[model samples]
Target: MSQDRDEASAGPQPAEPERGGGAATSSGPTDDDGALAPGAIPEDEVAPRSKSRWAFARELTVIVVIALVLSFLVKTFLAQPFFIPSASMESTLDIGDRIIVSKFTPQHSPLHRGDIVVFEDPKTWGSVPQHRSLLKRVVNDSLVFVGILPGGGDHVVKRIIGMPGDHVVCSLACSTKAGPLTVNGVPITEPYIDKGSVPSTTPFNITVPADKVWVMGDNRNDSADSRFHDGTSHGKLGSVPMSDITGQVVAIAWPISRIHAMKDYSNVFAKVPKP
Candidate 1:
């Protein structure tokens, strides 16, 4: 009995640990009172995460600024791309050929004869419009967006054959039957006409209206240019407005070997007779 009492009373029996669920806590600094202190984070886990987020934001901002600056530059003075879709100017510019056009020159300079130009298609050039694919658009726009790719808004490139206020006639009767175009009754020699295409077939002569030009393709037989669209003495058919002229092709930039500056028509037109 004594031994039993000694064992039981030797120390106050440890009270059964109170049964309860585990306590919820976030790792943080402990206060003097042993409670979590606010605003304290473990450096091991949170520090790296915070640093990563900050770095990511900074990088994103830098990339956005660079993109904006590049876009502005591209839209400004830099070279831009345009694709040839038709064979109207064939043998010189083929389908799938990409050319670099001079946007700045045409704005300040006069459009000269023989300048291979890209223009906003006058309703006279026909209804077709050129454009690039979605993927191509994304790539082009992401790099630099001067204008829409695939050349939106009815754009076509052709050679300028006649200038304003000139009496322009095709198939001037040569010895046999017909010859090249006659401006003011004087024959102008065209050396750039596509290799095999003849001078002219359909004949129509008209004085070009003021502030407008008569355009024709080098591939005379294969092209439907101002000559084909001209209306009879009965009515007016195809005539491009001077305002629709876009820009003259300054050079062929791509396919490096073929890269060469375009020959200005001024040299040839210098010899043409004035009305």
Candidate 2:
């Protein structure tokens, strides 16, 4: 009876369920190390993680492209930056100063006397083009085109003193000690002229043609402006064509200590009748 009980107890033991079906039973899925197997890690999980990284990079690239496009548009139409290259504007705008110009004038806004403006060099204006190496020129042109750099040495800046059909005259005897400049036969006070400078030393009398404007610099004596080009071979080049005007200088943007809104001296020309 004792021997029979031992035999029954040791029988079979269910063969331990053949231990995971057999070594050749497809062995299940395994990790990189062939240790963990799948389920501890999902089959679809790693692919999504890789896709998420790719998605983030794509999104970032799209945002950057949009930002660049907006910047280009703003610079081309609304406003632009320009740097002062000479002392032509003196106290109002100095050499090396950077300024922001608004495109609204003569478009969305009316230009007025005493309004500072930037315009294309009217050829006879005697502006000297800056010389630079080919590589440097390319680099600068690119930056300016993208609105990342201020334009300089190519355009001119001055204040508008006469509009279409206004009779502008400066007497030959006019000196720093002499009193005023006449516009439309009315003597006008110019508070913006350089302290020791006169309205004009070289006299001129002309009716500004239609669609043209007479411009001058604040540093009158030092500036080769309308007065110098009044009767040049270029024929009435003194008066810049309205189309040549780029924009109205709205503010000084550089040299933090010099940052300020540009002032329009409307009251100075208020008493003068329109011509």
Candidate 3:
């Protein structure tokens, strides 16, 4: 028993290469670490693996720092990415499309009609919990910090069809023509809309409240706007206060092939009737 015990206590026995010839003691750890005393690691096995790991860590830190700095600059003065989730702006923005919403203009002045802007989500949309989508949270939260979002994601992006105190109705009947969206009392022709979408499928007749504007998506058939939330006590669902309006979407900065300034609705607003 003593002799057997002595042999067992002799520490790890040398692992001889098996007849099959691969790494010996395949189930156990290999002596690749520098801590292996002297001959445990062969001359061929010696390399600057630790130094390589340290180099990798340093490079990764630099990349992260660059990303953070760019994010700050983007949130401060320039444009940033926003992922489109719904079909509200259908032809303009499809799901998975990344749009650039600027933070500079709205910070300086009131938004003009036809400007495509991102606002804080309305109360209903603003309260949806985080973790719903990491991309949404990142874009929404970034916009919030820059004052681009109304209240978190409560903001929305739409064409300003009616300005403060404008009595805007959806349709104006015509004998031989489809009625147009009227601001004040004149018909404004919007040629930007997708041909088949009927503007304001839901009826709306309202004097845009003081200090507020009426907004709607160009893709009128599939949007939830002031008309849909008009009577709900949830408040401010249908109309966004002028103060809640944020900077406009100036361009497309991603998917490189599609980059261009977001067309201003000025052409449409040009024909709107004054009160």
Candidate 4:
């Protein structure tokens, strides 16, 4: 009975766990507070992505601006699009034909007698009515300045017949005769003229003045060219100042069926000695 009482007093001793709970908790994912631990990221790895995007945008803007400037300069000083507004050029250049004119040609070389050229209309040529709205006008003028569109109003295209200081004469007889249209007493065969059209129905003889050129159209019968404007209000009707010449027609650029380079008329004037 004494031994039983002593064993009862030492009863209810603590027991050892079957699994290692402390080690399991220490090896788990989170800290003791149940919060996630943050990973270390290097300062170099967190680069400025927004800055890179902004830089790209700035570079694109610069490229677009440069492209626009280059286009404008080319149109203003090198070449431009010119639309044929009349049938004066006929088979060579019909109405609606878009041609490229090289402003550089007139600057580098003197205007030759057989070259086709575009020129600003003389004061006596009068003005065409403006049928466009303000918005349309602004848009068209802007596009034309950049060589994206053709010019409108007060511009004409013609072939040079007499250069500075050359004597030019015409006759209705030119349709049948080879020498009716003469420059400095030398005849020019114009095969480009519309068939059956006379060179000039109204005869006139004049010496082209210094710094001026006499011009005419290929479709002589239907054209109101230097011959038609003779003795007009400007007095210098048959001649346009070299300063008024814009550029030489180099090629037809639009309308897929009519795309071709401008004809070289060097052979046409080859026999004529320089004055």
Error of 1 at 186 (Å): 2.2
Order of models, best lDDT first: 2, 4, 1, 3
User: CA RMSD for every model?
Assistant: 8.0, 7.5, 10.3, 9.9
Report, for every candidate in turn, its global Cα lDDT versus the true structure: 0.68, 0.82, 0.66, 0.78
What is the Cα root-mean-square deviation between model 4 and the actual structure? Answer: 9.9
Clashing pairs in 4: none
TM-score for each prediction?
0.68, 0.79, 0.65, 0.75
Candidate no. 3 TM-score: 0.65
Q: Please give, for residues 17-83, the per-residue lDDT of candidate 4 as tens digits.
A: 4354443333223558854334424344555999889999999999988987898899889888889
Runs in model 2 deviating more than 4 A are 1-28, 31-39, 42-60, 232-235
Candidate 3: global Cα-lDDT? 0.66
Least lDDT summed over 10 consecutive residues: which range in candidate 2?
Answer: 36-45
Native-vs-model 1 lDDT?
Answer: 0.68
lDDT of 1 at 78: 48
Q: For candidate 1, lDDT tens digit of each residue in 43-134?
A: 45556777999999999999988877765565455445678767778788877777877767467778776778777777754666547899
What does candidate 2 score on TM?
A: 0.79
Candidate with best TM-score: 2
Better of 1 and 2 by TM-score: 2
Positional deviation of residue 61's Cα in model 2 after best superposition, in angstroms? 3.9
